[model samples]
Target: MADKKIWQELCSMVHPGHVFQDEPLGKYTFTKTGGKADFLVFPESFEEVQKTVQYAVANDIPYTILGNGSNLIIKDGGIRGIVLILTKLTKISLQGSEITAQSGAAIIDVSRYALKAKLTGLEFACGIPGSVGGALYMNAGAYGGEIKDVLSRAVVLTKTGQLKHLEKEDLYFHYRKSSIAENGEIVLEGVFSLEPGDVQKIKARMDELTFLRESKQPLEYPSCGSVFKRPPGYFAGKLIQDSGLQGTQIGGVQVSTKHAGFMVNVGGGTATDYMNLIKHVQKTVKQKFGVDLETEVKIIGEDLKKQES
Candidate 1:
């Protein structure tokens, strides 16, 4: 009853169409899985976002951020409270060697825009499948390049509801992570420092990386890119493959035979299936090599209702 009241209040605050009830979670995730969300809130700008967050916080409603639904799993039973998606707020632009972007803009779009502007540093993100904010929050990287190499600063909304600009050092970007994980600061926008380059050469690099991604990844299927973080000495995929976990299936989810790093949904897989497979892989890998694997994918939402004692 309380949850429904909060949902109704939120709807009244935003446009009617922007707030949805019992929204199917399957349509939003990269893996094309999950059950449902209590409510999904679409806020189109910073002001809208602030209002929504303030309301949620004031009313003691749980809220979680959504970024293109990439590299995430929202559980089988769905999320409580509201899922805040800023995707509609996307914007991108450039000035000299600097690129400015709203948090909602696709990182790949930002990378491509930089390339078209004859900028070199962001070509590495041409194949990244998340939004600019998501990439920065994870310090997302591949092929020896990372967001740290290009990010100058970010406009962030702190947990206490203050907006501030944070420099690169403040973000504390490191291997596969950032302080955003610790502080829960929501990214609003960012600027990247780049350099002018030859268009032909930039295109050549982007083309080559695109080829590598297309030819190697099982993009034909739906899945989170890499299931586990690199385990220091050995690659996650290599470890999974060496453990004989490749081509393994639970429900419709299969550990990619092409790239052991990914767990693809060849058909209609649920978050439950994905979670079971992950557990199986982790147990097996731990037994075989005495090493515990940590997931790179962010898993959230409640699997069971909170019961009173």
Candidate 2:
């Protein structure tokens, strides 16, 4: 937990009501299975984010940047220091064929917005559940289109709380990877350069992708979405399915029978259950096929055992 003096100073930086102490992180995550956050601040504007970050840096406090918590798992003991959740900073605008979205805005919503504006290129993101910030962080893609294909530039805050505008070439995007972390930059907004197209055509494509996603993904359960990255020449889900690991359960978490790629929290699942199940799947799959499955989901925080000790 943050010291009382530090907590008071943080609360003064933003809306006091937005500064939560010992906040339960599970309530914010898609998996609904994490622990608490020592300090969680929901900044409503870019300026607020800058101020909070500057305050943390000046005080020598560690801080973590959190998006919408869609593809993440927080551990049982929770995070120390401060966590800044950017969901409240959502805003989107359109100028000519270009669409600019604040980092916290949902990617799915941005895609729909693009379609509504008769834009063509963003149709592939119509069903993605992560925020624009999260998407840019991982260069998120689906159905053969990716952020790198349409992204013109991004506005980010450096570790020193200074804002920088970076062109697409500076991003260095790859499959589920970007230079965001290595550069210690916090994404503020994304500017996508799109083109005018037939709305009906775009809608049809989005609808088709949505149907395929609903049919193939385990959307009915609370999960972290696709658990592992696709290995070269092999699909993670297919390999796990071929290994006969579907319906496997560790505590209340289960490898979904619907989609082998997902591990769902059927009921009272914990982060430990999720971690254990992931290790088991990797071990089983590697032993069976000699292919190493690397996780795509971001897992953080401390375990209960370490916290108690």
- The C-alpha local distance difference test score for the whole of candidate 1 amounts to 0.87
Q: List the pairs of residues colliding in candidate 1.
A: none
Worst 10 residues of 2 by lDDT: 1-10
lDDT of the candidates, in the order given: 0.87, 0.93
| Residues 1-309 of candidate 2: C-alpha lDDT, one tens digit per residue | 348987798878889999998999999998998888889999999999999999888888889899999999999999988899999978999999999999999999999999999999998998889999999998898899999999999999999899999999999998989888668799999999999999999999999999999999989989998899999999999999999999999999999999999999999999999999999999999999999999999999999889889
| Pairs with steric clashes in candidate 2 | none
- Evaluated against the true structure, the overall lDDT of model 2 is 0.93
Q: What is the C-alpha RMSD of each candidate to the true structure, in Å?
A: 1.8, 1.1
| Regions of model 2 farther than 4 Å from truth | none
Residue 232 of model 2 has an lDDT of 100
